[model samples]
Target: MATSNGGLRNMTEGSPARHIVLFALPLLAGSFLQQLYNMVDSWVVGQYVGDAALAAVGIGFPVIFMFTSLFMGLANGGTVVIAQFYGAGELDRVRDAVDTIYTAFTFSAVPVTLLAVGLVKPILFLLRVDDAAYDDAWLYLTVVCAGLIGTIGYNLNAGILGGLGNSSTTLRFLAVAALLNIALDLILVLVCGWGVFGVAIATVVSQAFSWLYGLWYINRRYPQIAIRPFCRRFDRSLFGQIMGIGLPAGIQMSLVALGAMVVMSKINTFGKEFTAGYNVGYRLDQLAFLPVQSLSNAVTAFVGQNIGARRLDRARQGIRVTVVSSVVWSLLMAALLIPFGPNLVGLFSDTPAVIDAGAVYLRCIMPFYAIFAVMFSLNNAMRGAGESMFPMLDAIFSLILLRVPAVYFLANRFGSDYMYYGIGIGWMLGFTLSALYYLSGRWKRHGSLADRDRRA
Candidate 1:
């Protein structure tokens, strides 16, 4: 049987479903809290600042995501590396992976921050942001990018702990940060009247707090794999391994973000009302998809550990469990969201047009969420087994080759509503590709850590 030692749980010896569920619950809660604070930022800005401000904040997301996706992808690769090492009882390698990740992020974040902040206005202009929202969007993006280190630090910290099979701690960190974020949002936006800029400041401050607190906690509790932020411990070989898996994933994410920006530009032409509606609807959609995303993360860690332990059967079982649970959860959320989405969107804006557009966005896309869940689950399982290249290509094929073009063609030909239809079409294509790949069993032969050890 798997045993718990300190904060880590051994996943190699347990009922796969039970282990996965236990791990994913905290992840689910943590994701929800993270999204909650983001929603709160939009709410505070929308309710108090105005619709243009709401649209501005909304427009900034994809640009920020584009800047951060590479680092986040690398962090995910580090998680896979750490999980496999921890699973194999190689504490030293786990520490090395953690250190290497921190080192990489520390060096990379500075340039990325500088570049993002410098190009914020250009990017917004390229996206053709509405004139009314342009200034606020620039302000929000600049402030957030200036503090990019905090977001990278906090997410990487969560990734490291999650790889060690300890997700609960991350949840606590998020809960505290989420509360702090809400408080700051209310004070800065409502009382201080800082508007969209205030919301951005609150986000940066809360993220920094979480990152600092996580650093302290990790050093105090998990001395076995403690992170030394300033120590500059980079392993050339390990860095190669991490990037070998991570770079393609990063490219995939960047392309996906680019695709989103393209679509957003198209949507922007419809005016700020539609853009604001799309933003709120997308936030709610993210909330709805949290359970599936959490489950996908769980499958990645679960599969990584088992693959490291050379328990392919257990990994396969866990993947099956995750896929089913994700699909079912997606369906449940769709059912609930479809009926009440208009009212939910209304909470953020009083404009009837905004409410209707947001509701339509939800209705058009929610029912097909199961398709997305299945694709994500399968792709994450491949990532855990160190087969990132194929998934990256698959994402490129779906998001870039299919989704972006479809949205442009549809929106131009049919209307804005067809833009959502294009999204659904991309999800279906992604699922088809992912399912075929999973069935081929090619991912099983990928060069996982355990496979490397066996060959050596």
Candidate 2:
């Protein structure tokens, strides 16, 4: 009953660990390459442009993320819906869901771009982005927003392929984009003297290329779900279904990004050195946890497919395997990052203060990565099972209600060194909630697309 053709790999019939691991490897590689290009941007700006530019890029991240989180969440929901339909052998529904996702993102991208571009200055002012970095931040964010269509398109394409259990193809797409981005960064920033604007242009151009390439590849290789940009097929019922699941997840993502902005505002008070250092440390942290994130994504798709196949036991088994693997990976990363954290931070800047500040952040948060992994794994499993609302509530409670306030209180009371402790505290709270909910097995009742079909 397992099908493997035209880049699709059925997960419902394999050894859960094998399926999860094989699927996750490519995702892990793709994430690494994606992060690599991002780090390259930071490196170019920090080394060639200056710490102010570095800080500017950092300032723009959470703001852009906040604006785009809704679409990302909706794309995630589309992935789940498509995965479930694919697992249940409903090819027609899968195609319909894919088309609907494409249609929705295409229509909405322009409006979101305009809104985000208009708000960039106000949001930067609110975040208290330092005067030195404000102009670069505004320009960089504006250009990126102007090309939001490319970013959204790339992500939706990845989401659709992921839903079909074809993470490998996306890996290839990312590789092309990553190389192009790195080349463009060097050429635009160093050769052309474009500075921060060049960096932003590089990102936009590379992502646009990747999106177009993915569209062409998908149409050529997987005609079953060919995307028709001009036809504009919009499925009202499917769009509603995607919204039902994605809206809460989108709200959660937005709140989380907002919380990050709040935390960034606090960090910005310390000066650009600290902001740049935090940005470098955060980039390193993202790299360290890439495997865990990939495994969590694998679990989501795995659980979605198995649940759709009505194989609850397989879904449970896959979750256990992924959690264990993520914990072990986190432990390894912590051991490595804790000792050499400063040295790695030095790669971006030669400043002793920046390196020291970055080291402090890593030391504070690295040890608690296992807790973060557990929280994400369990919560994502619930999302995979169509139980997205509770995960949204959990993120709101732990990340927004608890973490944001804790960061502010800790920074004000103990100092900046202790600010990252708030992140660990949030992780603990999230893990506790996720564990309790996962154990109750109520997620199984959340109902997959297949279950709805059976009932009808």
lDDT of 2: 0.90
Clashes of each: 0, 0
Tens-place lDDT digits, model 2, residues 285-397? 99999999999998888988988888889999999998999999999999999999999999999998899889999999988899889999998888888898889989999
Q: Which regions of candidate 2 fall more than 4 Å away from where they truly are?
A: 1-3, 454-456
Question: Lowest-lDDT window of 10 residues in candidate 2?
Answer: 1-10
Per-residue CA lDDT of model 1 for 1-456, tens digit only, reads 554767587888979998898889999999999999999999888888899999999998888888888988887888788888878888888888888998888787899899989999888988999999999999999999998888888878888987888889899889878999999999999999999889999989998898899999888987877889778999888888788777887888888998899889999999999999999999999999998999899889899888888889999999999999999999999999999999999999999989988998999898889999999999999999999998898888887889888888988999887678888888899999999999999999864584574465
* Error of model 1, residue 310, in angstroms: 0.3
- Give the Cα lDDT of each candidate: 0.89, 0.90
lDDT (Cα, 0-100) at 21 in candidate 1? 88
In candidate 1, which residue ranges exceed 4 Å CA deviation? 1-3, 451-456
